[model samples]
Target: MNQTAVKRLYLMQVGSMPEYQIPIVCYLVQTDDNRNILIDTGLPEFIPEEASDFVNGQDVVEQLASIGLKPDDIHMVVSTHYDIDHSGRHAAFTKAEYVVQRLHHLDAESNPRFVANRPQWDQPMDRIRLVHGDTELLPGLELIETSGHVPGHQSVLVRLPKTGATLLPIDAVPFGEDFSRNGQDDGKNPDAEAIRASTVKLLELTEREQIGLVIFGHDRAQWEGLKKLPEYFD
Candidate 1:
């Protein structure tokens, strides 16, 4: 039999970052071999109305149900970082092996920014597969180590059979201006140098791989143009 590849990519809008007025996203990848991989669970079960600010969508579990997937159906979970919006629903999945960069996990232990989110992403050590630097987690799926947005932050690249390779530089390059402008400091992350380097790395990869589809982390314009769930990329 031929090697399995990602057969479907689902883009799910889990909530909105009201302060910035952009939709918060998470993704689901269904492989041709009947495996599912989740990329960054959305918000937690509850948040004060004040904290929610304005728009908020369904939780990750609920979103998964729309396409007939439960928590256990997921085989792997990739945590790009521990930011509140990205990792809030992580505790919902107990069966999947969580993947994260070792340094990011270490930094999360003491870094105030990430420490606050320990409860969300600090899964059992037995189930956490901490990798250093970049790695190909699956045949067609590769994790791009792109720190600076936060320490040990990582991005994703999924090469599908029909749709081709897609670059998902989650938070590493959240906005299109980060690309057209050559990755300027967004004032959100102080590690501007790291952010720039990671951006350039992703850009070079995008060029070398000839990747045409790039699903950014929280770009409203980009999200609006995408083929959202119920519609798969492949």
Candidate 2:
């Protein structure tokens, strides 16, 4: 019997804020075929004055370099959502194709908050691949539309060889505490019911799939416990 090779996954810590003690990070998945998939880009070194104090100089390019990778090494960039903190430094990966939900792309284009940071994703339309609900990016990697924090928000589910299932709930459940409480209304997304529903859906999927681990977005305590860069979960 021939055995299938498992893809390698890494959690890259890009930046953090002292005030909230939240570390901004991204995930890198190396496919069996040697392709690199980036989940989300961290905040840019220079942000708007309103957010200047929160984000410091932690370059994503430098973070990738620490793992012996470069910006151009990335083949695919997956935007969980168009939030500034998530997609802020996406322009760094110039050669990669961007994957975003159709609804997200539309929302970012019209939403004034997203439009203000448009330069981060100013790449040509040809480089973008707009996916709908529940799209599969690779054999064992799938994008699950969670859509609560934002209209087109999604989470990634990676079926690992030894680890079984690992879910990346980026901002869909910003913190484990929020998940424990059944999610909160952030007022960013008007549909509070949709957010709650998405959270429940994730919980159901987690139970049904027997997910071994869940990486919550902006979870300070959880982030601290995770294996960072040079270290990774197989």
Candidate 3:
């Protein structure tokens, strides 16, 4: 794989919402060397019906196959955050090494504000790898530490050889417009300051990195414009 040649990456929105009809996204970052790296598995049906309602319906495994991938085919699983909707049924990627920021995980479980409000993802401790700081998953893909929404929350930064750079902001700012209107304050969570700081960090990153794309956790419009799996980077 030539570093000089542009690499194409893709996003797969597996689950769906009845309200919006938008699929819940699970990313697939293909490197120059043909490595398949998955990010954030979707929710499974095993969870309570009410809890599962926020997620998209299609099985994440089947969704991957629609794009020519099986669960075992994934090399690494990058979790942006531990929200029930985002974490989904991670057990599917039994063979992939899970990656997440250490601080984000600790804060999510320990912080009174988070524990009291969004306590869904506080899973059993044995789930996956608890990473720290920053990690480079592949040649051009790196996990940047941006923890605002939850303690262990992080986002992905992919630098394709040809496309320059793209930042998968995750839930740092729920939507691209969050930063624009100071909507970082959720009114419910007390971590508003932390969330705002994380958003600023992302803004700084994209400006400095010359990022061509910015992906969010639930940005339906953005995902709709992106190339999906199996047909990525054509």
TM-score of 3: 0.82
Segments of candidate 3 deviating more than 4 angstroms:
1-6, 19-23, 50-52, 107-127, 181-183
lDDT per residue as tens, model 2, 152-188: 8999998877777899989888788777445686666
The model with the greater lDDT, 2 or 3, is 2
Candidate 2 matches the true fold with a TM-score of 0.92
lDDT of 1 by residue, 1-234 (tens): 687678888999999977788988899988888999999997777754434663558978998999898998898999999887898889889899999999999988887765555687988899999999999987789999999888999999999888899989998988877774366665766798888889889999998999988888889988999998878898
- Candidate 3 lDDT over 1-234, as tens digits, reads 455322777677767665865557777777656667778876654655555456556766887788778888887778887666677657667777777788866766666543322433454556557878778755677888876577767888887666678788877865766854366776776777777778888888888987777877677777677777666652
How far is 84's C-alpha from truth in model 2 (Å)?
Answer: 1.3
Which residue pairs clash within candidate 3? Answer: 6-162, 15-56, 16-56, 16-57, 42-88, 43-88, 102-131, 104-151, 104-152, 105-152
Best by lDDT: 1
Model 2: pairs clashing at backbone N, Cα or C within 3 Å: none
In what order do the candidates fall by TM-score, top score first? 1, 2, 3
- Model 1 alpha-carbon miss at residue 38, Å: 0.2
Poorly placed runs, candidate 1 (over 4 Å): 48-55, 186-188
